[model samples]
Target: MNKIKNIGIGLLAVVALSMGSCSKDFLDEELTTKYSTEYFETAEGLEALTVSLYGNIRWHFGYEWAYGITLYGTDEFTNANDLTNEMWNTYDSRLGPIGATTSTGAANGNATSPNALWNEMYYGIASCNTIIANADKIDDEDVRNRCLAHAYFLRGYNYYRLTAQYGGVVLQTEPASGVVRNFTRSTEEECWAQVISDLRNAYDYFEGEVYTYGKGITWTKATAAHFLAKALLFRASERCDDWNSSYKQSDLEEAIDACSYAITARGGKLTDNYSDLYANWTGVDCDIEQLDEILMAAGHNADSSTSGRFGNRTYNYFTPQFSNFSGSWVKRGVWIGGMDFQRCRPTEYSYEVYDHVNDARMWKTFKTVYGVNNVADATAGIEAGDPGIVMILNTKDDHTYDSYTFGASKQAPNWTDDAGRLPEWTVGSRQTETSGSLTAETGQWVPNSLVLYQNGEYVASSFTSQPICNFFAGINKTDDGSRTAEKGDAHRDVTMARLAETFLVRAECYVRLGNYSSAMADINVVRARAEWKSGENRSYYSDGSQAFENNSLNTGSSAEKYIYSNLNMNTYYLSNPDLEVTTEASSLELTSFPSVLPDEDEAIMTAIGASSDYERALNFILDERSRELLGEWQRWETLSRTGTLITRAKAFNAEAAPNITAGKHELRPIPQTFIDGLLNDDGSNLTEAQKEAWQNPGY
Candidate 1:
């Protein structure tokens, strides 16, 4: 079943829990106020309610599975598996075509299936509404408002997700009364407007207090403002260039104001070490140095009985094989050499775009396997001869097919000529049987030929074979050596909304307004935090030598050469600082550019700078988001907002298919079942225009 159906069932269980109660003696007992509603009436009750809201954030979108599928499926850089293909087919992306399902009696609408992302989001919205309506009735004023704010933020956040995905949706401000609530859709504009207003209410109601989870139910001004900023920013992006749309430029201004408020209130700044922010999953356990950037994070405590099974532990999903050290039964056989598992792998495109040496993020993000040489090292001390072992390539079915064989030798070991080397071992037989007593000249004992069991029997010489490797098998020890912790998940965190994003958003707005100088300033602030050398700033033309002139910025051949050369050089230097720049340093130290450029050059420089700024902003935000929020379920949203869905689709399916057409594949189809169900029911109550409007394009 799909996640939505599962969550729906779970929600019913919660309702059942809410209804069942212990009976009270009516006549004999002394009069006492009922504590049923009172259970959620006090500060402690409200606090638990709010924690539940925060806890909901972790599973907001089933981030683990969604992120893996959408991020890889949308891009040209990564490949999709069967599960991802199933998701992609259901979504708007063209990487996979939709197929039929027997249970639903339709091509796509199994509400019980996990792909019903739409249903899951609304369920969250309903939960938030319950909290909001009930919290207001509490006697404690302070506790009441905090709970209300959290609920408002959650509802608004959920709506934000909904509008972004489905465009227009039925806005349920209050809890549904009946088990089956059939509601009509709201306009996309109406949905966003409601989202804005709800967030604004959260901001206003929680203004004075420092809201925190577990302490007491009070909305800290910071959390409210942060989400408020996010809502505004989303609105601004939608309406930035398209004035005819429901969004307005005022929204952008509001976003900037809200973000500014958050910055001032929290005293937060982006940290230099991007990796550390994610590595420290629990904000409390983070190093002192990293505390500045992490505004607020969902905390997961593994030891607590309250923690869920999938809660805090970084399982086999993201870690490399070596670090896990669990048994072979659970090992996925993919290990990060020394890195931590963050639950997603970077696409080749992501790795290529990064500055490997200076970025620091790349090293912390991925691990390179030493391949066969390392395997040889673990095998009996006898070094495997020529063509030093190449690490086995990890295939799509690596977890299912690959196996370790103990005794294999070259059939032409004693051959000196090419003709002799062309024996069975060199041709069809890449391996030879070795007896347990076969001793090398060095007196090292060879192990008996070890064959993996296939279909419950040993497969002696099968090359293209499928053998399941047990990840939970206690560490393997052979006479050769020992193999422990063979595979593990990677450890990296995905960052979604950070201070740098705010800066870049402001930079984009300033550039649009022709405020070049202001734009440059905002751009530089983010660069400074990234630890890019001050002198390497792209703002100025030369190292305090020549003042920038608008027309001159791109004119002279030397000037063009210098700028292009420097930009490329800087990118190379930043990405790979380990490499030496021998030739350029002799003539001029390229790193010594002036910090500020002249006002005249602001137009031209700002254009170039803005382009760089935008690319960096987009790339950094996406990359950082991928790195920090790897399993957090923001990939699809990021792709949708950025309009990179088709680009991602092409990248992800490069090996198997061609690029998908952009416009046709961007938005998801209104599920066929939803369309048919809606059309068949209650059309008699609708106007012609309303009915037409209800249908999605191409339906």
Candidate 2:
């Protein structure tokens, strides 16, 4: 075993072992050599159990499983080339009460099932129960209250996730001692109440101070308050219409107040630079978790030997297969541009949500240029340190090349064709009408793949003008070039909640209560930060890779000098007088609800045909969330809580639209493994009718 350096080292191993080996029961076992009732009676045991709860958060949010459940089947993304887990995104008939299994009848956890999330959350809840049960053993009042607060926050956090996906779940507040299978489900209303109550108690216990028990990665008062506000918002939403009549107005008011408190609590504020929040390229030395914007995060140490089992494997999911098309610019051995797992591909609506002309976030969030640094590109008449593949998110009409005209319409050339070679010259239509008619335009990008250029002539790709599966835009948020191996886990912490999201949450509350002006006030804060400011180099970009190679941010001490000092931030820029055109916009703020949709975004507008002012404002807020928090692992729940999952998915997501139903697709079916193991009060197997009743509707 690795040496224990962090707070969660002691009990996490035992929790993992218990969860992996025991599959018949739900959170039924807790085994440790040093753990006993007598040992738990001491202060050290309570502290260890509390720390293990934090570690359990890491276990729950690890790798692609977390992404599959939260991000897939939403409007923002669809299954990429790698369709190993396509059922999650497609919402086909295969997504049912019975979870996925191998051909040999063994349980396959993350392929197409929510069992992994279910087990991990319940296991963490078991640990939280242990801490709450034994916190009184500590003699120090302050220490006892701190440990209790941590337990309360984590328990509420787990239940919050559980109820969001599985509407009504088995709520167990006490630690399970043995295998007992006659559990019943709690109402969704009861579950949300528990979440709100626990989080409120946790906030009161923390005494209005931000606390960090681990390596600056534990929950604080602000974290608790943020969740509390989120819970209130969810309860007040249409999802809880069955029971939230009396508490709707009060919930909205309290939620708005909680958002205000969370914003100022513990010196929390949105970071001045939006890129600074995700610039975690220095492994454990990176101060991302310590930033004032972060409310809570799952800690992962840089040293794999001690960072627990799944050490930030999320770096592989959002990245596209860059090595397939831009092989000369990116190599597997030299500079692997993220692992190309290609799990989550951005939809057409995802790219269309941004104001590509004014929003700097679109450029910073997605990689559009692949600079060559290899000798192989010379064979294709390209020199080193030149752009090999440049993606234009606009239509050909905006970037027509006179040399490449076809029939009445002219074709747009790649970045090499523009004589100006200006950095801001990459403007064009988001997606032109495919047949030059309004009826034929789906708003999806046409001719998605580019024809390569060799010696100033077009070279046909392998797909013959079709958009290849492996060739798509890459997401820059999860980029981590600091890993030593191509497929190794990352060293950065997984961000869960932040101040910007808190502001958005408050804005959402305001929208729900018919306060459109206040909602826009909060939305403008984030939008203003995303605007391209004066005196800023518009071409200089870093998706956590350039920042690591050149240390352009001046991150660390002078001793650690990384390679590629020549690849400074401005290496990709070209001196052009027209660069100032990008800053011509006065502001990115929206003064009122958008009544008319632009031609490019007509598809999304048609999908959500809002007739009321309230619907228009709410839908606009949802789009703003997509613009700000894409691939942040919160899309599915946001849509589900707002009761817009079906409408939005039907409108934007091509794969999920046909299979999604109104009432059936909102909540995930309870895991069939757990349902099959249920017993009656007489200790007999549950009847088939009873089993069907226990499952979610339409499962």
Candidate 3:
């Protein structure tokens, strides 16, 4: 990042050129003009600078501290198999002055956040102020309006993310013309007013115009409307239940209106298939861009040249631990996920939120099955240098058949169902103990067990639908083919705003407004889209028939099977199942455990009828978001804004439950280094006690 210097006109112009574009294609153009501040005071230069904002600001939103700090340690996630960021997960004060460094080297130097997101957001605000203070320089009418709109939208977005993180941030409306020493924290009301003003300006600029958006990747009127509603929703939420509050009756009305407009006017509706929303495998060859459900995304490319402008490091951070000490699991640009970088993993609660048999989203959201690489050999040991396949087995039904196994073949195994043998066949994907370990028991890796009713008795249940990897897929990079990639290797566009999240935002507002009926209606829309059945037509917007329901709940007895999987356990299963015997789910019925619709749901859904009105309403919305928007980087802000952070964290987040308190963690503490550097309006050095007084409530 540039030093904390003045936003000079010359430097701003160079920023416009140097940052370039964030398109699917690389910015390969060279500057042909000896341009200065005077030359930049034109339509083309302003447009160029607007594009540059996407490249620059994404560094804050797409990379580590910018987004990661808000993503991990929430109800949905914790550190995975590895102890990554244990301090943060445990809500230790290491998140603040415990490691505050004033040196530029304190941070990675790209976008400095010596303590939290202070330096980084200020850097973004500085650029936005530069564009906003000089937007009128453009001669063309449309050009002038568009430049101002983009500057306002970017500024509003940055402030929105900041307030959601650090609450009532330093509002800088003017350009940082010189070395700025004086810094005053704005009140939540004041900060929110500025956010509303900026987004309003952006929203008005794009009113009723043909949406010629920024390369189909940047924000438009649709984006502004969604954020405006989101900001208003936060304003009306418990975040504003504070001293000097400014939440008006119109807060709810305006939020509902704004969200309704985006839903109606924005073309970003839900896609037919839940799986399509997560097709981010640019490096794994599924290079499809999101259009139906996606409104705006931070653009990226497989070519790593411009990755610094828009790289998703957390993609690796959130992936499961897939690599060994030797790092043999990946190649640079082939794996869709990661290499043993288990920085963030789904908590047990995350996996439990979904109704797997009914919710197609569960299967789409996580990579549960993988091609087992028989690395020793596809067929182990025979006559030649290659471990050859045995053409024929002794006999199964006293019949002889050639076992075609040297290559891909779907021929069923000819081996008898021996009580002491592991089922053998070079075949299709199946559950395994580990990523590539030669064991049929998924319990060694994921908890793979079943609870079912046998022909006449309550008997041992064979497994189906056990969770393989937590959250999204980790890494399928086994280095077996020409296509091999490493952690965070894919440079696909990362989604930031989409319609499904908008639906959740609207639902949260409905619940807060005491419109329970409306909240449930909105939630049902998202849920109806997620449910799928086996043989339904895969047409547009069709919610297939329910594959899982209370088939025999009226009887209300343990005579029926209760759906069991790794989700029922808190730790990874240590032993594999006895594969010598197995039972099929087809022979038994699967029902939701502690069944919410039946008596079985009593264990987990304990507060069903006993919870307070607010608790019941909020928990439903939280679970719906968890079920629909898992690993989408919106959970922390949602809980914090709703004032449910403490309660939900204690209940769902195993890592942060012990350390998180009621008040202190609601807003992250402003870095002490930034506070110590500040001066009052009178230009005097602010003292420590004074700084503490101005800081967040408890820190």
The prediction achieving the highest lDDT against the true structure is 2
Q: Higher-lDDT candidate among 1 and 3?
A: 3
Worst 10 residues of 1 by lDDT: 473-482
Tens-place lDDT digits, model 1, residues 290-315: 24444444333212221332232223
Task: Give one digit per residue, the lDDT tens place, for model 3 in 1-699.
Answer: 001211133345435443543443323343333555444456666566565566655564444563356666687777554433455566665556434233422222332242645655555565567677778777677777877887898888888878888877778788654455345677777788888889888998865534443234456787888899988888888767864244645787788887787887755357766655662232322323436466667665544544553454545554443322111211122212333355565654665565533455654454332221123222322111111111111111211112211112111111112221222422212222222122233222111111112232221111111212222332221111111233333344556888888887887778777777777667766876776644432111110001112112212221111111111111011111222221212111122211132222222245334265656666667777877777766788888887877776787676688899887888877767666666665566666667677667767
C-alpha TM-score for every candidate: 0.59, 0.82, 0.72
- The global Cα lDDT (0 to 1) of model 1 is 0.39
Residue 620 in model 2: lDDT:
76
Pairs that clash in candidate 2: 394-428, 394-429, 394-430, 395-429
TM value for model 2? 0.82
Residue 556 local lDDT, model 3: 29
Per-residue CA lDDT of model 2 for 495-539, tens digit only, reads: 888888888899888888888788888988888888877745455
- Cα misplacement distance, residue 245 of candidate 3 (Å): 6.5
Candidate 2 overall Cα lDDT vs. reference?
Answer: 0.64
Candidate 3 regions with alpha-carbon error over 4 angstroms:
1-40, 98-116, 208-215, 243-248, 280-288, 303-305, 325-333, 374-489, 533-610, 680-684
